[model samples]
Target: MARQEPLVRAASAVRTVVEQGADDGYAGLEISGDRVLLWWKGAPPPAVTDTARAAGVAVEVRAAEHSREELRAAADRLWRSSGVEHGGQLQAVKIISDGRGLEAAVRPGRKSPLAPLPELGVPVDVVEQEPPTPTSRCDDGVPWYGGLAIRPSGEWGGACGGNENLRYTCTGGFGVHIGSTEYLLTAGHCATVGETLLDGAGQYIGEATLRHAEHDLVLVRTDAADRIWDGVPGVSDFTKPVVGWVWTFPGQSLCYSGATSGANCGYTVVKDEYTKFCYEGRCWSDLIAAKRKGRFSVAGGDSGGPVFSLINNSAWIQAAGTVTGTLQQTDLLGNKTEWVIFQDFGTATRDWPGLDTINYLDPM
Candidate 1:
């Protein structure tokens, strides 16, 4: 865990420079095994490199083809022009972490006219890939912790509108406080505002108070605590206290839990600021992508579960993000794997200012 401090300090310095609009040609930043890699389109900025060095960390500046801002603009233009074309064939779009170019994922065997899009100033690398689908999960308990299964009230065990389809379930995310109101976090696509959430045993959990469909995040005002279930339901029941939240860096290790899949680890961060096209022609952006190592780490009904990393190999944990869905990507060997994608808590706090996980920092 101590190895993360230098990476954190270096990231802070780079973030400060970008936030201040003094990034120069900065493209992105990543933590690669205790070293900070800063990608820039042209000459590396002395300000950011010097600041990061002064923070007592090793920093490497690499040349990039395009800046993050440029890639984002290019991606937006491509989406605007080709999002609804060919029945929404475009699956996803993101800036290559190494700043090589923009990556546009389209449905396999489908033709998309993405190359001639006007105002797409940056280079685009098109690939055939399937779009990710939203997943939703569980446990039993009080003070309602994250990773517990929750479903819409009145639809959990029954069919709605004369169909045998039961309501889809979702896993609770982190417990957060917006002002004095306590709320449980979950995937917005799981339920709508004003819908009452219930546990598997038919107990009232809370009512969805806030929903952000674009980011796939929802807040439920309820009785909750700042902890995540550490054990799998029907097997064991334990929890770890949430100390605070942390930003996700590529190559960092993480673990996630859901009612359907329980807890799975050995996941590595792959990318951030990804925009995935989902059902109903919608696209959710600013998502973090983590690759699974072994057996599937995510499945249907795992949406809104907690994604975190252990702190100092102890029971305490730092909040990372909330599961959104899984993406299918092919490797150089042409092997396809389902990757767990999540909405970063950092984006959550930014979207809802003053929002924070109910943690040890709170008053007793």
Candidate 2:
């Protein structure tokens, strides 16, 4: 398992330099194992190289044909022309990590192939696939911990219950404090604003006050604790207190706990700032992507669950992201693999200023 403290420092430091340095050639960055992969349109900048080296991790500077800005512009143009956002075959579009080109996801067996838009300045890598969803399949409570079952109040939802009552909705994420009010967190797609959230026992937990559909995040007004359920759900009971939160990075191993799927580990972070189109032109950027190290990591009711990294191999964890949804990728050999899509906490804080998890900096 990856430790949180060192990884947080390294990633935060590298990201700070990247944000401060207005290098146009800056393609992107990736934390591969213990080293940093710095991609650039030309040669990597010396300041960035020195910073990465100073972080006490190995550094690999890569060359790219196009800059990030150019690729983003190209992606926008592709979205406008490809009609992927307009309920077309295009599932998602993103600037590949290597910064060489853009990868466009299109539906398989569609009637018409996307036209060769020579107009796009960058090369477009097309992959036949389907788009991801909000993962609402539907979590718990007064200082409520995360990873427990929750759903729209008065609705028969979630993976719990017997017989026909097995309606799954979502899992509660980390609890946060915005100003003087405390609130629970979950995926925005799970429920609309004003819907009251309830536990399996039908106890009132909170009310959905804010929904950011574009970012796939929701804030429920209630009392929440800075802790998460790490147990096996009815089999074993264990909980972890969230010490802090960190940004997502490629190759970072993490885990998640869902109400339906329980808790599964051995997932590696795959991509950052990925832009995905769900349905009818609805799209969002800055979304994190991870590949399952095992057969499965999340399920239909896992939305809004906590994505976290272990702390020093102990039960303590650091919040990473909110479970958004999953996508299936088929290889040439007909083998299918699933990937987890989420909105990281870093993006959450950036979008909602002064927004932070309860006890975020409390001593572990």
Candidate 3:
């Protein structure tokens, strides 16, 4: 990250100067290698050109053919068709204003695309990088995934599921009930359909009945109902028992529990923008951002853990959702920070139709 920090700082400085002329022709900025890339139209004015050169960082300026607004619209069009399901070739899709117009920054899949990249209506910028390791899956040496209990979110279930010769460990968050059936919620990457799950003590707990990689969620058939809602800790000793949930507001505080880092108490919902979580080229799209000031919002083995907000000084909590993955830091400071990206369980219920209840926390 030694090369990344200077780019971030330089980007901040450049963004201030360029975005001012976005109405004129400044398209956008991107970091490629060790330099900051700026896309703009026409020749630079002395005042603006001098400010950019004085930024004290490496910079690359390109002549953009289209206006910023036109490029933005093109990016939005690509974003809309990202999930059209062309044999899952699109691992991730991001809009970047390029010198020509817009570039769809895509993480290509292992398999080839059924359709051509030009069909997306934007130029495809294939990113070359290694996929993330399966940190949340059950491993023989690491036992960092857990916290199945409702009240304390303590360590109990993690690293579950098995094939003929492989047994993996992963955290199973609190329980949920729909009509007469109960299920354990966790990340889909933890286990596949038909795989059996185990607890921390290696006890048989459930079977993986449902998994949606796009949402990074799995539903395990289990008898572990929601336990007592004794309540989660709050700021300044303001504790409240979680009774129900409300939709996420912009500036609320959200927390989560997991095995590696145990209980992560304080994190602010600083961003609520769309996010992406990819695993080994495969991806789970349509996520939101949850961030804390200092430390990471989540680490390995923390996947599938519940994200909730304490209400008032009481246990009335907002049922946010489960942790998905981390977001790439997009600033110039090279300040690598962790962002706990999650999908709202409230919005997720639409996928599970005919269900009597969805994401309802069990009472003690």
Candidate 4:
């Protein structure tokens, strides 16, 4: 219980703003370290600040003139307006700073240089970032070690793939419902409905029956959910079932475990929402991203893995979401890095309508 004190306090303060209604300029909320961030559609009213200032935890109130979704659509239109060759290679789009505007990325070194985004009555910035290298990942086979497919005998997080010859593996946060229904959660792009999920030893476990691309999720139906285990290679111990999960925050500490990689710990969330990514030329928004504080966050085949946070010194854990993809970035100085992308459980919950108790791995 003591472990939940800070988060409990933050949630209370956040509710204070959420309860105020849209008339008060509050459009969105996210936690940032010790503070709760209340993003208003315009300048924050005095009552909002008064509530934040007096709250036990620190608070940040900012303005976003328009909702992030609106800006996301506007960004899409901006890209379409370009209509030039360069726009075709553009990777992703996202709202920037206080939701005041938008930013986009294009293939590095513009052989087909793109013009500045036309006036959209909002701040817009176009930057250069390399498009992820597109290479054929599958051709009549799948990697058994990817996506942390389950292994029989009560261990999990092995590899799950597609039924088509073009199999691509991805991991999902495992869960249980009722006394018999079992499920595995992951990104929609990882696999589709009816595809069989395999374990470490290549035994069939379940099939994906639900998916929500807008939410970046795919839910697989399984027979039994005994426990949630992570495929961290060489690490025998892992967390047990999830106790709970916190909302995404600007600077909240978080971690993840993928089939391509083991559990990655100690990183800060850059922003909570309104993030965007493109898959196979289809662009989507509303995602979470985190940087690598100690090690790389995620990679291919790691999609649909677990994004979680720990409490009580690893004695308890919470499931945030399944891995979506990574944001491969190239800074102005040409320095390249990648951050893990995730779609939290709050969104995944939509796929399963009334299911309770999300079972996730906890360190033992």
lDDT of 1 by residue, 153-234 (tens): 8666322112233233778898899888899998888889999998766678899988888888999999888888766654
In terms of TM-score, the best-performing candidate is: 2
TM-score of each: 0.86, 0.87, 0.54, 0.74
Residue-pair clashes per candidate: 8, 14, 14, 14
Tell me the lDDT of model 4 at 292.
65
Which residue segments of model 3 deviate by more than 4 Å? 1-91, 94-146, 149-168, 227-242, 270-272, 312-316, 328-336, 354-364
> What tens-digit string does per-residue lDDT give for candidate 2 at 168-276?
4688888887798888888888778999988766678889998888888999898888788876655664778888777677777778877767777778787545665
lDDT of 2: 0.74
lDDT of each candidate versus the true structure? 0.74, 0.74, 0.51, 0.57
Ranked candidates (TM-score, high to low): 2, 1, 4, 3
RMSD of each: 4.3, 3.1, 13.6, 6.8
**Ten contiguous residues minimizing lDDT sum, candidate 3:** 228-237
Q: lDDT, candidate 4, residue 120?
A: 79
The candidate, 3 or 4, that scores higher on lDDT is 4
Between 1 and 3, whose TM-score is larger? 1
